[model samples]
Target: MTVSSTSPSAQSSATRTQTSAAVSVSSETALPTSETKQAILTQPLFVYNPEYIAFLNKSLATRSPEEILEWALISLPGLVQTTAFGLTGLVILDMINKIRNRRQLAEHPVPLIFIDTLYHFQETLDVAKRASEKYDAPLQVYHPQGHDNVASFESHHGQELWKTDADVYDYVVKVEPGRRAAIENNAQVLITGRRRSQGASRAAIPILEIDSGVTPAVLKLNVLADWDYARVWKYVQENGVPYNVLHDRNYKSIGDWHSTQPTAESEGERDGRWKGEAKTECGLHKDYFKMRANYLAAAKKRKLTESTDFVLVDSEEPSSKKIDS
Candidate 1:
C-alpha cells in the first residue's frame, strides 16, 4: 500500500503546468467579473449545473467503487479523502492506494483529511496513524481551535459539554474542525465514507452531490454509496486494511467516546452512534449555514450570561465591603 513520493523538481514543474492550464481556461471562459475569473484560475473547475450532476449520478450508479475512484482521481482536482478511520473509509483508502499503484503514480493522488474532534476513542486515533503510515497517504489532521486536549477543552467549555449542549459541542469539536480542514487544504472534491447501508439520511445519497453547505461549496463523492456493510467488510478483510479495534467489540459506528456505544447484533450499523438520540449524521454533513447560525446564537447567549454574572458578583463585592466598613 505504498505510494512513492515525487521529486521536488517534478512537483514544481507539474504545479506550473496546472497553473498555466487554469489561466488558459479562465481566459477562454466568459466570466462576468474579474473576481469570477480569479476564482476560476485559483480553484478547481467544477460545473454546478443540476442537469450535469444528475447525469453524472445516473451514469455512475452501476460503476464499481474502484472505477468510480479512478474516474474521480483523473477528473477531479483538489481531491481529498475525509475519514474517521471507519471500516468503509479504510476500504476507500486501500482502493485508492491500489489505483495509485496501477497508474504508476509517484505519490498517492488524493490526500487525506482527518478531523480529530478531540473526543474520539484512543483506538480510533491509533488506527488513523497506522493507516496513514501504511498507505503512505498525505494525512492532514485538524482539531478544535485553541484546545489541544480533553482537559483544556473541558476547562473552557465545561465537563461533558455534549450532554449540556449537544449542538454547540458538535459544532465546536467536529463541524468547525472539519470545515477548517477542507478550507485549509483547498479541497474541492471530498471522498467520504458514507454508504446507503448506514440508513437514515445516507440511505438515498447519490454517488456525487454538490454540498452547498460550506462557504465555498464542494463536491461530495460517495464512491461506495451503493455498497453494503457486508461488501465493505469483505474488502477490508481482503485488503487487510487497518481499522478501529472497537468494531470487534460490537461498536459498529464510532464517533465521540461519550456519545458512542456498542450495539446489539440486530441493531443497525450506526445505532451505536449517538445512542438514544436521533442524530445520525454529525454537523459535518448537515447544513453548514444552519450549524454556524446555531453555534453563533448559543455563543452570544453564553457570553451575555457570563457578563451578567460578572456584574452581579461585582455589585455583591461592593455591598460586602460597605458592610465591613
Candidate 2:
C-alpha cells in the first residue's frame, strides 16, 4: 500500500523537499535487459507506491518496451499516456495500437492526454492531430485557461512570457494544465516519453517514479527510459510511426517555435529544447508546487508594469457613454 507523499500537492518525485518520500535512484546496479516468460504473468508491484522500483529492479528491467507497457496497462487503471507526438511518444502510441489490436484490451486501454499551449508551431499541431486520427487514441486536450489564442495569452501573461520568465511561461502553458488534466480525468499514472539518454536532468530517470509533486502525487512510468535516441528512432522508422515534421528539419526536440530551435548534428535529442539556456526538461516532468510558486512570484512582478491600474480614459469619447458601461 502507498502512503501520501511529503507534500499534499506532490505530482512528481521532484516536488518533495523532504527526503523520506523521495524514491532515490542508484546507478550502482544496472537492471537486467530481458525477463523470462514466467515474470510477465506476475502482477506488477505497487501501482501507486515507490515499491514499483523493486518491481522494475526484479521483473520489468528484463522486459521489452511493449511488454512493460502492457503490464502498465493491466496494472494502472487510471493510466494515461501524455505525448507531444515526438519520436518517442509516437513510437509508444504505435506500440499501444499494436497491443490493443492484437490483445483484447478494454475499450479504452489507455487514454492520451496532451497539453496544447496554444503557442505550438503549426506543424506540431498537425502532427498531434494526425497521430490522434491515425491511431484512434482516446485523446484529451487541455489548454491554458481563457487564453486559447496567442493574442489573449500574451495579453494576460505578457508577450512571450517564456522569453521574460521561462518558469512562469512553463507553469501557465504546461504544468498547471497538466495538473488540471490529471485532476479532471482522475488519472493516477502518467506514462511519459522520457528516455535516460535525453541528458543530465534525465540521466537518472527510472522506469517507475512516485511523483508526489502535485496534488495526490502522480505515478510516472517512463517506458522508454532505457532506450537511447538512435534506438527510439529505429523503432519509429521500423514501425512506420507518424512523427513531427520538424524533426525532418534537424529539430530533434520540438516545443514552441520561439523556445525550441534546431540542434547541431553533434548535440543530443533534447538539446534543441529551451536552446541557449540550461533548461532540459519542461515543467511537465518537474515538480509542480515549486513551479507554481515560481510562476506566481514572476506573475506578481509583471503585474507592476502590465497591470492596467491607471488607464487614461478616452476623453474624446462621450463621458456619459463610458460611465454607463
Candidate 3:
C-alpha cells in the first residue's frame, strides 16, 4: 500500500506547524490474521461492510510495499496466487519468492495460477517459464477447454468471437476456465495484480476482499493494490525480475495476441489492449452475479439450439411413435 503524509495545514501552510503528521494507510486492517480473514470472508455481508473499505484505504495509505506483502503473507490463505504476465505481477512474484525462501512460509506457499487464454505473446510464456524455474513455485496454467491450441480454438469458434460476441467468449474461454481452476484447487481465496490508481474501476479496490460470487465463500487479496506503476517498474528493475518484454514496445497492458497492440498515447495505459472496446476485464474479476447471468443466458441459447437440432432430425427421419399412432 502507498502511505502518504498529508495534513490540513500542509496544503495551506506547511511552514506554520513545524511538525509532520502521517496517516496509517496500510492494507493490514481488513484481516489481522490469515485464519481470521478466511473465516470472516465466508460470512455474509463481508463485502458490504463500510469499515472494510475504510480499513483498506487506511492501510494502503500508511504502509510500505514490503509491509503490505507481510500482511498478505500472514492474513491470506487458500490463496490462488495469480499473475498477468505484467511487470507489477512479476515484481510481486519476486517478493513472494523471497517470502517462500524464508523456509517457514515455503512449507505452505500460495499456489500459483495463470489464465492461459492461448492468446498470449510468446514472450509472456517465456517469462512465465523463467519465473517458475527461478522460484521453484508450482505454477498451474488454465486454458479454454475442448481445444489444445489457439488454431483449433479459432477454427471451431471463429476468429472474432471475442469481438463479435464478447460475453459468450468471455464465459467459455475466460470466466468458466478460471472458475474451474478455483473449484478444482478448492481455492477459498484468490490473489490478483490490481492497483487503485489504474482507473475508476479500481480506485477503491481493497487490499483484501470477500469475493461474494457464485458462493460467498472465497476471498480475493490484492497485495499491491496501492503500488503505482512507477513503483512496480522500479521493483522489477531492482530485483531483475523476469517479465514480458512487450512492455517496452508500449504495450502497457497485454492480453490475447490478436487483441493486444502498442499504443503511443500519453494518457492511456491499457488502451493499447482490446482496441476501441470499453471492456477492461475479461470477466474473471467481474461480479459473480454478472458472470452467472451471462453463463445462464448462453446455456439457454445452447439448449434451444439443441432442441431445434433434435426436432429437425426427427422431422427428416420420421418418428416411430407417430408411425405407430
Give RMSD to native, each candidate: 13.7, 12.5, 12.7
Residues 51-74, model 1: lDDT tens digits: 446656776776778878776665
The full ranking of all candidates by lDDT, starting with the best, is: 1, 2, 3
TM-score of 2: 0.77
Number of backbone-clashing residue pairs for each candidate, in the order shown:
0, 13, 9
For each candidate, the alpha-carbon lDDT, in order, equals 0.71, 0.67, 0.62
TM-score, one value per model: 0.79, 0.77, 0.73
Give me the candidate number with maximum lDDT.
1
lDDT by residue for model 2 over 1-325, one digit each (tens)? 2444333332345533222221232223222222321243243432343443544434666777887776666544467777777888998888888877776443446667778888789998888888877877656776775555788777676687777778878877887777766665446678888888987778887887777675343577788999999998888888778888888899998888887899889988888877778887778877787987786677576553423111222334211110000
On TM-score, the candidate that comes out on top is 1
lDDT of 1: 0.71
TM-score of 1: 0.79
